[model samples]
Target: MKQTNYYLFDWMDFDESLSKDESLWKAYTSTEVKAVDGDIHITVPYQKQVLQEDMLADTDVPQRDYILILRAYGDSIVRMFTSMVDDEMKDTGSYMLELDKALTHKPLSVEFADNVYTIKDNDGRTRARIDITPYNTEWWSDLQPGPQPTIHLTVYPDGNLAKGVELSDDHFSPPRYDALPIGFCLTEGKPDRATVSFKCEADECFVGTGERFRKMDLSGQTFYLKNQDGQGVNNRRAYKNIPFYMSSRMYGVFYHTSDYCRLSLADHSSRSVQFRNDRATIDTFIIGGETPERILFHYRQLTGFPPMLPIWSFGIWMSRMTYFSADEVDEICDRLRAEHYPCDVIHLDTGWFRTDWLCEWKFNPERFPNPERFLKRLSDNGYKVSLWQLPYVANGAEQIEETKANKYISTPTGGWENAAGTSGASNFSTLDYAGTIDFTSEKATEWYKGLLKNLLDMGVKCIKTDFGENIHMDATYESMTPEQLNNIYSLLYQKAAYEVTKDVTGDGIVWARAAWAGCQRYPLHWGGDSESSWAGLAGSLKGGLHFGLSGFAFWSHDVPGFHSEPDFMNSVIDPKVYMRWTQFGVFSSHMRYHGSHKREPWYYPTIAEDIKKWWRLRYRLLPYIIEESRIATESGWPMIQALLMHHPEDKTVWHIDDEYYFGRKFLVCPVMNGNDRRDIYLPEGEWVNFFTGEHFEGGKWYRNVEVPLDEMPVFCRPGTEIKVYDEKVDSTDDIDWQKVKTLFIE
Candidate 1:
């Protein structure tokens, strides 16, 4: 085929058959290979490589740090040489080669600084840098004939340091299905603006990262990173920020650097993917394992792990946008107890303050008559209160002026222009965390923590921390740039909030929105501003499932849509929809019945009975849900699991998004369409229906199963156990563990 030699320190020349070792190099055949200005050009998939300028003439050549990149159609390995002599061009000094590929494969030679190295990738276990040589060599070996193709490079050879060679080969290794060669792929157009493309395997599906959206599969969708105000789950502006996602069938991939990057999947003519940013080289790592559980383990090893949540926050939470008066809240709690409907944490939304000024941290005296008495009454009734607050400070508020004077606010010049809406209408402002008391600054974090500590000491058990999606790219921090701080702002804010609450109460809980990669350390995030419709219910489930796959263990949503105000029995807002949504909500990590309209069970006359039934069901399943949360805190596994996570080899489970395995034991198939029957695919196991006690064999798809409006199709995997609690319980405090019923599926 082709032959090439590399001279290292005028001592060694390496030659191999390119056809025999397919793992090392890859070659593509086409009639379009041409030379332009001494550069090789190929236009099939679109790639070009050439040596433009030589820097060896300068005295800095020996001390300069150089990076050599090789792009091939399949897998390829790279080797580096140090020092070259004119006569000993075949061999001389030490050479170091780094093997970069997804599969476990070793290069021919590896030389460490201290000694010559050898590596072996046997049985998928990589053992690298086995020292083979004690000192460096400086002599070249005679070139031998080989069946494979090769390329050669000689720096300062014949006084020309930049010249290199490329050879043709008749034999080269074919590309692997899962392991793509570490090289550049074509974007099929002019390279003015860079684009990324990738191939989507016929049976494969991708999941994880980005904000929660309406569509279950993002196979053909185009996504952008710039933040906007598109509110609903289906629409664009994603509040939560996460740049890492895991593919269910293959390895979990993460782009480590915080740069503007784009991913295209099966969109081009060849269905190839191209990931590009302004940076020269892409910094990425692949976590490989056959199962989703092992993949998550490696993922958490790279990122930080999630922390444990307190036991009390596991029960039912009640929230509404307009829970104005303290007496009204007490009356509702009394009614819940009287009607045997379980309730734990009661959330007071925006109206809790007098002037609707956020972050004021004051109760409306008229509506809340006596703050201490109201809190004491709720505490006496075994319910905690969660107050809603955001990071924003109103312009005219006292805190705003104080913060500005203290340099806690972002400087005017460093702020990004608010182009989304009118200045007065848009709730947008930058908090400079660098020189100022912004979340990015240590001083600002302490300042916000002090505020939260004060609230926690005032008998508030939970804080519903909202907002944080739209952080300006120009905002400053001490050591980080604005773009770097954008996704991280929410996590830092939540950390400050958590620290403050924990300092005061010894235990803290926050219901926050907008998160990033490692934000799973903070518990309880909610889906924002869903409309009050049947479609919104489906959207909530889809969003929650998507979040669960992305490493978020705890998630919640408004039960009946936070923005709808229609009659409960209308076609779009039927009682069946409310009941079904409630069933799904209760199974989540932290259950909350919240909406713009009154979301209490008794508010809807048509669905009142159904709500009561589902409320009791939630109470009964509290033990299982709480135990699952504890497991998630310890293991980094999500409370809600995709089937593929539990079974990676079963290809059928990879794309089944509509149905998800709640926790580990229960498989929940939510009815997305307005029908009493839904189809679900079971993965290689015997399953017992939780509601009907019907047995179904797995490893196949089941269709048109009858499930009533008041019932959710929940099944337990074979050889699993679930614990059920008391149906009439108001709190989890004094529940008898011995009295719990354990269901064992075989």
Candidate 2:
């Protein structure tokens, strides 16, 4: 085993008692916070810890590094990076998500008072400012008094924004922040962890920590910022963990660190929104937008926008958890042709690679004997192929041994413990046997892409890049720790896969599961591992809505949830739930029918026609869907637009998490309950029901609307023109949009 000579992270996740652990201050952060040349530069004395034995095994370090630097771009957006520096900023290469520096600038005006720095606009009003109560290590008392210091950056949403209104500061922040403070605070003993608290204002709702399932109002929920394959619908932890939150306060609090963080907005801290994580340098961003859309727009501008997906990708995809053989896939394709159920792509799950799924990337000779010919057959049948993949390489796989020979696989460091310059518990990464790709290594990235290129050459149209939640420990490319690469692992992996796929096909589409802030650059990530229940179905909706706010341009979900465990071998899905899921799935950004239980229309013979009609309708909406997809690429608006994203002024839709707009117009209400009639909100203006053609005025709730198992509520806005193709085709291979009916209704 390789050895590491760096401090390991030693801390527990979400341990609430840390906030009260007031030990005599052994570590102190002395600093000078100031603005220079249109940017804020904060310098701190670096602390070097004395180790007992090996740096890897040392539980706690006496000192850690700290550097705080802040820069504002285009006014309201402020970038703050808190880094522990042994030397200076390390040169990390040209990564896509790197901050774009501003050439032209407007210097920020500041008023300094003791330890407080207030940033103001040229109009002489507070835009955003920080208050830092420095810790005093020299203070001596009866038992040596410990200094408890708090650091907070509070911004006014309407305070003289660069491109927005110059509303007064009194418009946003109420007097409640004093009682429920939201800011950053350092705890004693745990030098590597910091607790961040935000005041829970009246009607304060938090969203977007990357694809969570709880209610839209995350005010009383504890969300763990660690990605896991959580199959259960109610699991608090998610598959994609981005340390960011968009608030009703019109300001966003984002903690940009790679450590596993505990974001608690639950009753545990009912008064404040907070998160606790192992201390490294925190590079947090406080984004101020006038509206939710503006917040999301600037957020994507900071991270990165997703590339445009090909038009055909907008059509429906047919997928199942496991398709053992090529013959089975062909049969499904043949059946779809016989039944006239339109599908653009067919996804063969993990088992297609190998039964053990070691990710060898070799065709299972027994199942897919002649892989190239089989792929050609799929193309000949007018179907695009999508294969499943994960970053982890199982230990006994031949590729693992081969990569080990080439030193391509990352050294197993057992989480942050064995990582450089940090101490952490062995809690986050438990998949020890599965080795990960060392993407930072140029040789390794090319070699891995070569293997994927072989598949692309075999007619695989898309790649399902899955399971990148874990970034291997120990040293990484550029001598950085896994703590530094943890959150970014998925981003880099997707980039490599995307680059390779784009090289083969004109454009690439990856159905990714795990993501970070900038991973949206790779479009089409699915809600990870959901069960087949009404809860899971509804949970998937929340995931898409939240993820859309997180800046992903496009998102997909398993039509009828993922697994039905206890009966893994014999999976079964409820017919009504499946029907409702199909109705909602067809209306989503990218409709993909995926689950462990068989998703074939033949399986549900009773509602087979309904399922076919919905699938055909998905094909019918291809023109509109493709246009919306192009708009997503151009404007960074997700195809599945959250109700609140388009209508933030309508407060009723802010809390309504279940229903959302399909594109720029059509309202889609997913059926979650047993009743044939459910409540649907038609926002401001006349709306026409797709089924009844009855007109209704918006700005009011229409309860008990007819939404059977076969159909959910889909409403079109008045005076908007929609082009519907006269004929529904099974594929996008040959389509004539000229032969479409244009409906302009009022």
Candidate 3:
């Protein structure tokens, strides 16, 4: 492996033909090399390197592209290939690349055609590219050299370096290679179109690289690459981020990318996996699968997968900008329940904590007396609690002191420093999870975990894991650099809290606001702060649908608007908005009523009756939603699916972002506007209106339908079964499925 201070590059020794100079392929200065993994690290010094014109091939062939192949260690090797088309080697063409187990005796192929070159795997899958046109390099000798060889590639005006390979003679290859960093293994095999299989010991499972909807454990089951995020365990984020993962089954896959991704298992451990990216190579890996899938699955999964949320979590969640006193909170919940309005979870905004220290995690005794009893009372009434919290630690927080004393927090320079300032906006004072807690250091993770444990013991059921997405890249960590930690900060923080919650309560939930590629492993993710207009609601749904498409499963948003006027700006709570949003929320894997303003039905009495009706509708639909959640937990399918997921082949569905498919059955067309009528499109399948039992033809658009204030457009695909429950129930566990009615769409 080529080892640099920051990255580990896989290395390999290939035939002389693959190198610029046959005899000096392994020479240090001629081809500077570093061992990151088994991957060969090669850097070319600019002035010292020479390219023999004769040795350069005129690869441009019309109607065909070329693939450039380099072989490293059969497994865990990282390979990169660039192409030059035509006699004028100035313009480098598109190239394909792959890294994985090496093949025996098979030649890697590169195709050149129409002034474009294509790179493919042993099986011929295109990976990455450098597009070059003949016009741009009419005269090859016209190019000037500075310190490196000028290989012509596409250049973007936005300062993006594209379409070319930078050549330098400063090659520094390390003499001896070492194994990959922690939790990795090396294997040997060839790259071929044929499926490759490896033996995994019994109980070994796979995790990482793909967007999954369940907890970070995949043992005794198989998974494929498909992006989806819904309101369930597997559905947490709006989109999938990382295309790579390490398998606890001993090996892992890192699909090289910049495009759509896919992963399929041939069988448990005795299987072949494939990675596909738009302009990148098909990179695959194989390793010894010996440990239980649970351990490796979670290990890699935790690296990507977030934790599951708490169950009391499934209740009605009410939120608004501020709820100052415990009495106000009590009054809101009491009014909702007293008025027979369904409600469960109560959210307290930034005001619940000490005003002097904005996110101290300490309840203000003045406003909230007898915190324990107050929470117990809410719990007794079937209400669960969620408190808003960020990664930032308050300036005077006792926890900050403890964190510093234990060396569990990040230091600005060399000592304890406040990460969250009292200014209320973002502060550099926030604890950098990537830097603060030395997760690699056993002591740090333990110290941080203890703080969360105390909260779990305090009856805190859910934590809003917020603001991790905006981590500053300038911060430093004693263990990990800021850049490396920036991407995984959310994962690390969520994992730490999740671990503690699980230890104390067996299972816990975190409603994280910001995330990176693998943040989906966490149970619930909400859209970032939004406004209270129709556009905001529409944006919320679009964000949710987009996130689902990206690979997040369970997503929630503040009801109405998190920062909108309580009266909805004199527009009144448009029943169309409430009704449509409710329908969408009910079909979601998890539903909650939240916003910056009070979202309780009684708050908007004009729509209270209709809101109650929809609340009942949601309660009745719990069985179906729950079952969908279970299915999502088992399979990677999201509970809230985009229409394209159901009709992938339908070009129309691909651009239909305004609507989404709720699970496999319901098609929800939310009213993004305040208009009473909506235009809805039905894909090429018979659809039945849920409320009216009206059937609509597939593959067409319908307009001018007078939607009642109490209804949103909901269509159920023909031949699907829907389960319903009583609206009065407090918890899903007590609902009798047998007593619930099942409706057939047809």
Candidate 4:
């Protein structure tokens, strides 16, 4: 759908934010205007804003950041960045990635005309206009009186802003040692981590904080943007932490900082949203669009896009905790053939090497006596093979000494120094065993990739790039402090593996665990270890949805979580949970049936028929999935999208996480909490249930949408066209794509 001009709409999208009583658009207006050098400065008095509250007049008011001039990025974009200068005029530069350095910087041309400061560029288009106003008086910490300067941006063609900072009057503030001092702020005596909130309805919410396991709409919750490796459904620490999020407010905000930050949506403040980065400067990009999907696509232009994968990668991948020996692998292949189940890729997880969880690239001779013959046998059985490995060289391994000898190991620091208030103190999961590979050193990356390449030559098709989150913050790097490289370490590790694989063969992909902004440059990523329960299933889906909105298009999860560990809470999943999780997985971009326990359909005979049915459906719809994968590569839209992305105008879809649009056609609502039914909200159109072919009108809720244990609630929207294979195919290499039948619903 083509985007509509936002200016024509009577209501601003942000009005749906939790702060419904006070509209951000209605409360503030242009007052005074001036052309300051190359920028436009417009000011608005606070008597019209929150400062007007009668109840706050007696109480000591907190200092608020004054709104300043606006900068236009050529035609389609505008930006706001704070250059923090202290009393001495000393400044702290931005600590985030300098993304603008790579883009075209079009200088702004400012002109004063008709009492309004007109801001334009070389193209002679009036991008924005600034009208200044008398500043409002603000009370500082010592009850000092001061006037606050204000600036407002008018995105001429109507395309931006609604995200700005407001300081809350609070005595308690977190220590930000890692951030350059900014108590002395940009004009307004705002707190170090200041805030700008959306006055939205209760229904408005937030989505992308990469790889969160809880609910998708993070409206009232406060999560610190620190990359701590955590497990379980409740733990707040995440393996992937990218400080970027898309809002139901119809805009995208990304704080370009590697430091700790906090974003609150009508949580602490009764009527406003907030943003506080650990650093001194608040450098961010606010992208606007008619729909969340288009905003995401524009956001992708700043971050990187997901890489394309080989066609065969879209097929089913089978794995267990170990698949230890060659004979065990062969027996599994033989059993799949006996059951007439379609299997394309088989993974040899941990214990395939000399020792379990050791980053040894060599295959264990005891387990696989002959790697060559085993590879040939699997190839003959129509299977591609993948091996597992991580970046750490285990302490006792022979390669540990060898890796250190060659200066590849990360040198230990005296201790964890440079603690960043909360991140360094609150979360501690320090690994004592091995040193991480120093990827900043090109020699180390090449050495590790060389080892992986040697294995790829032998038999392994791809490596399950795992466990990159637990880097030693004290470890030495050639350039930046290890603390600076902490969150992005996964990218360096995954990039080495991906680039090496791509160099050797024409194709490469990694089923990785963690990521940052540009990590999507590597194709595939999977959810980390999850327990075997409905909550875990929901968490995996939630995490995928969150990660997808962050520009990482392709994502997968442990179909039924690998819930068995010697020390952790572990158990085989209830058959019902496994079946339901598999139903959701079947529609995902990449399908994989994996777990610590025996995940084979034969092992759980009760759901065997259901399992086979879903597996066959995966293959039958392979051609359609492959085409969608191609579209995803071009558009940066995920194969699985929250219903909110496709139907932003329909407020009902904003809160739905259990059901989402799969590949732009089907609304898949997986049964959660072991319920035999669920409530599904279909957005504005006609849709038909996949199983019963019963049609229903959209824009209404279907209560008690009966979803049996054997069935997942999937509905096809109108104007859908896709391919269906006539028979179950064992491997993607064998399927005749030209012969598959196509189905179109108009």
Candidate 5:
């Protein structure tokens, strides 16, 4: 067994609270407070402690005073900052765009009494409190065994009470008095890390750690916030990682930083949710609300809300790994229209550039002769084009020399062959000797955006921003460390592409694969590469659910799956799996059919008719999808909502992951396998089957219900009305909203 090092954490003593007995941990003692520009600032001098171990003597040296600042936004949100070494605290990345505007909410009541500072609202309810009373260590020498008195911050939301304790009328006390406080960790006499620990109930559940592929509930799990190619949907690593999570305790925490972070949601100790930021300052926004929806509203307000997507962007997109020529794209479009298949966008992936997978921002002259005419012809027929590109320059590629000469590509700190800097210029598969485009530089951003602008001028409606998760974490950038810039690189890259496309074509949409907190403003993002298997389909659903919970409004996954076992050893997807995945895709916020194989419905003749049936249903439900998506963007909710988002009070719904609400009306349960039986749990209402007209009461379990492959378990709430466009059309452009009809279910 590997030995655990307790000293890595500044607060974790060898015997938990044993530091209180020996006074071996240094804590802050508040000295002065000042109010400046609607913010409270405090100076806290460190009270030095004597160390008993010689190994830790170096870290016990005296340090400067810590600066603690607190600001309130309305009644529900409180921003907290603990600064070390006078670091200028700033939002260095694109994480928070409307942070300044969010401070215009109603003022909060602030008070400090006997070393405890509290902030309340007009209702005289405590929203946040900071307890900094120094502890009398002698009392903990076996005379009094209680929680140690250290500086800590706690946010109070409505209906939060201590477990196994009831409130009395005389004197009110908060529950769970035995959790650690927020503080900094000293390394070699300098604070190098900041940690925030919150009290956790035994039944407390957490969600939304950014596109997680595991179980729905994030209880007893530790996650790292670093963007990496998830490779497959079955592991912990993901392309999108956000340092934000909401608890069933009716509160959420957004650790505001671009650096690497570690979140332990009661995985190390069952009593606390520990968050560690690898930086000198602990800057966070502690949001309290009455429900998870309210919490998400504040989170999106602090960050930016997702912009409304173009109406055509909601239509079905058809794509594959590589469409090698203009003839291939033409053939697919022709076949879809001939078969009366409804699709609005045709995406050309990897093969639009001069060389396949080598992106120089130019269409292949030989393969795509008269590109402007071709794009115009496609546009005339009510079809849009989306091209794929990444922010990487191959060594022998045409544009590498120009980019390197102009310093648009990121190299080593001093040069490409600097000492211990070979990883920055390493080869990536067939794209040998690659270099990452530095989005941090303003000149480079315009240069790259110029390339994308030219494509949009030729009628490319959208740009697929891909492969941003592979940035070297140790490379140097324009003004920030790689640790602070790698995860946010996804945001910068996609923002540039989305803005340029919207500027030229009037549609701000990108088929992005990587994301951080504020990437939702870019309109749409999709799940990364997934394997062609049953587990892959299940994992993709879980990923999308968690992504929505993380404050994203639009999300989609590759239909069926992206690749197969043994690296595309079998090109053909299983027919049943294709049919089942097609059912899942129709109800998504945006639908796209893409994989290693041909994703056209005609490929599987046995199930071709069934595939067409589901596709038509998607068109019929387009009216509901558009309204729900608009509501989601405005209300800061996800179009594809997990059951827990609406039923957080129900303990049974916390563990149910496979079931979800497609919109306000329909409950979609995807069939993942060939099995004819599955269990479905409905929460607290009457549900009517959308297909079979069967009714089932909620608040109970229905076990082993028989279902056929042709039908999924789709149910709608009682007395729900859904608008449907029942007219036959080959694309969304041909449908008129005035001809739509409504279906009322009861």
Candidate 6:
């Protein structure tokens, strides 16, 4: 479907009204300052223009004053908050910040001299400088609103006061009509909205903001920081949106809010990066680092680190859109083992309930007559059962009336009759007028968990927490308004599922699709709904690379893509696409084969042997993958790291998005296009090809490197040792730890 510009259709897609007009925007002028507990707090009274016959008069407009707080976290990270209502800005009571327990809050010293406030760290090194002078403000004309006092934030990323870089506000004059004075402006029409603009260098690049699929460098793009049903992996719509970005200038900015916002990174204006939020406060944390990895490390410290997943989750998972009956599942498992394909999990998607996609949380007795016995049978055979469910209760679901009566569902403020706003529900064809589970209510969460607990008692090990993106904005919740709960809804929903799974199985895991900032604590998530094409494969890889940079560790995508051309039922996926996608899936942090059609390798007979080869290699490398996952959990690094993360000094590798480091050793350049050879860039290290033991020089691009269909282009450092299972195993449970052997790359 074509995207519509109708503002009322999808309000999340619309820009905030404050960015439209400059005259309605106002700034708070600094009046006084004080220090409490070594933290600097400034009081800026709100200012408005008094127009008499279209002429400005020196008159004060009495309104609430704004409080700006500046504090330090350790020596590198600084928190800045600007608000009118609260003395200190607080999170939405959301779980976005699960700060590391070892994070120390250090007191920063502030000094005022020559009309400038300098903030220094414990070592007395300058961290930031604030200027609130008349020169920092902008105006258009005599009839325009006069300049108000604006706080100009200049940050010293290197802790050198002399080398401070000033993030630009809007530079507006009469002839510069392209410029809008949106630099730190509050909307007069709606007090809840705010916009902040920062100047960007001409050649600056940025990456992150969670699971973006468009490009690796977000230099000239605009991304909406809100979760939505992307429909496919080829669009700007994202299932995971984080309001944080790492700049090419060796600094990071994390916008701390749960409200839907827009991040224009040099998109509209070539020299400005503007952030507009639907919230009243401008709260952000600026982090300084010498490398991108260090920036991500501090980011993970502010939020939470990724949890270690179970050993079996690293193995191949067999799944499709709908696995209907127990007999069909049994046949697939039998064929998988018969064909010597190593598998660990079988996910039953959207077909486990009495009606397909009904999500009643009950097994279809006709298809799965004995849920417990069936799950135990699979469990005994070394396979885990992953059940699929969502947070929405459909209209015809058996538990809908119960959920409504218990007030476990989010209802419209004007009642259910006024539930017609588009929250991207039409993407999923079978969706009905449903009630979204009110995860904000503690009672509602417990009630929802009780339903899953029944299924957990029946031996299901994993829960596929799907579809937390399509939330109605006008709906009412128990604790927060819909706007407040919009972005963080996925985090809460995934947390409930992860906690319940751990409560039963002792290994917390949820195959979640949607996410926010702190969703990494839930262990695993996947790229959503991709087309079964080469472009789909490329797009999915780009999304994963950006997601890894955005503080997530484990991520997967549908093998051979999720949706085929035209439709999933009628189109036959190309055999080469399946083979190459299988190779890519085997190298990811978690591997799963799923699509609209039957995704079993046997469907494509000619390439079935090639697909099995990749599966066996994955099992052989399971030990290495598990150890790397442990490191990823402890450190903030991702399993599939972008090339720039490992070598920030190598300027040539900044834009190379197609290749990534699988763990710390292997550089995986997937065969996105089916060809006999591809170009590979070895970044500043001695690399040995994993397949043929061919040597390559450092800091050079190898064009058209000969690669076969059954082989992936993987390179590792010389003499790098990785553990591999020396024997064939049908599943992760069958692997003998004693038989693991370390293989040297060189």
Worst 10 residues of 1 by lDDT: 5-14
**Candidate 5 clashes between residue pairs 3 or more apart in a chain or in different chains:** none
Q: Which ten contiguous residues of candidate 3 have the minimum total lDDT?
A: 177-186
lDDT of 1: 0.56
- Mark the regions of model 4 whose C-alpha exceeds 4 Å error after superposition: 1-75, 83-106, 113-118, 122-131, 135-203, 415-432, 564-570
All models: lDDT? 0.56, 0.67, 0.49, 0.67, 0.76, 0.79
Better of 3 and 4 by lDDT: 4
Compose the digit string of candidate 6's lDDT tens values, residues 1-746: 12333211122222333244222234444566666786767676554433221212224645446677777776667777786434355533447887776767666777888887777777888877777655654555576544444556676744855434455534343212222222223334545556666777888888889999967778988787888898888888999998998887777888888888888888766777777777757888788777887888888888988889999999999999889999999999988888789999999998888888778899999999999989998999889999888888878888878887888998877786666643244355455746789999999999989988999999999999988987866678898888888889999999999999999989899998998888999979999999999889999999999999888999999998998897655598989889889888888999999888879989899988878888899999999999999998888689999998888767777688889999988899998886757888888868888888988888999898777787788888889999999788999999888888999877
Q: Is 1 or 5 the stronger prediction by lDDT?
A: 5
Alpha-carbon RMSD, each predicted model: 13.3, 7.8, 14.7, 9.2, 4.9, 4.2
* TM-score order of candidates, top first: 6, 5, 2, 4, 1, 3
TM-score of each: 0.73, 0.82, 0.63, 0.81, 0.90, 0.92
Off by over 4 Å in 2: 1-34, 42-68, 84-106, 111-126, 129-153, 156-158, 161-190, 196-200, 266-271, 354-356, 413-434, 471-480, 737-741
Q: How well is each residue in 613-691 modelled by candidate 3, as lDDT tens digits?
A: 7766777776677666656554345666766556644556545666777777788887766676778889996888877
Which sections of candidate 5 miss by over 4 Å?
Answer: 1-26, 29-34, 45-64, 89-95, 100-116, 121-125, 131-149, 157-180, 417-428, 567-571
The positional error of residue 644 in candidate 3, measured at the CA in angstroms, is 1.0
The deviation in Å at residue 504 for candidate 4 is: 1.5
Give the Å shift of residue 665 in candidate 2. Answer: 0.4
Which candidate leads the pack in TM-score? 6
lDDT order, best first, reads: 6, 5, 2, 4, 1, 3
Model 1 lDDT per residue over 1-746, tens place: 12122111000111232122111111112223233322222222212311111101112222212122111111111111111011111111201111212322222222235532222222222222222232243556534222221111111101111211111121122111211222221122211122222334545466776555745555544445443444767675677645555654455554443444455433222233334332223334344544566555555544555676777787788887768888889899999888877778899987788765344777888988888888988898889889987765556455766665554545444342431211321232332222223675676667777777666777888888787665534445555566655556677778778767777877756888777666776777888777677667766666777777676778888776666635432324556667777777767777787765677877678779878777778778878887887787656478877777777777666556677877888888877656788887877868888877888998887789777776778888667788987537777765777888986776
Give the alpha carbon lDDT tens digit for every residue of 1-746 in model 4.
12222210111122322333331111134455445554555453332123221111112333333344455543344555553332111112322232333334445667776556776766776666655434454555754333223333444422343432222222122110111111221213332332333333456678887887767688776567777666654468788777777778677766666656666555554344555654444555666666777767666656666768988888899998778888999999988978888888999887788776554788789988999889888988889898887777766567877776776867666422431211221121232345778888888888898898898887678888877876756567766577667777888888888887777766778888877767787869888877778778888888888888887788888878767434343465688877888888898998887777888888888989879988889988888888788888767489888888787777676677778877877788888777688888878778987767778898888898676788777889666777788776778877987788988765
Q: Model 3, residue 465: what's the lDDT?
A: 70
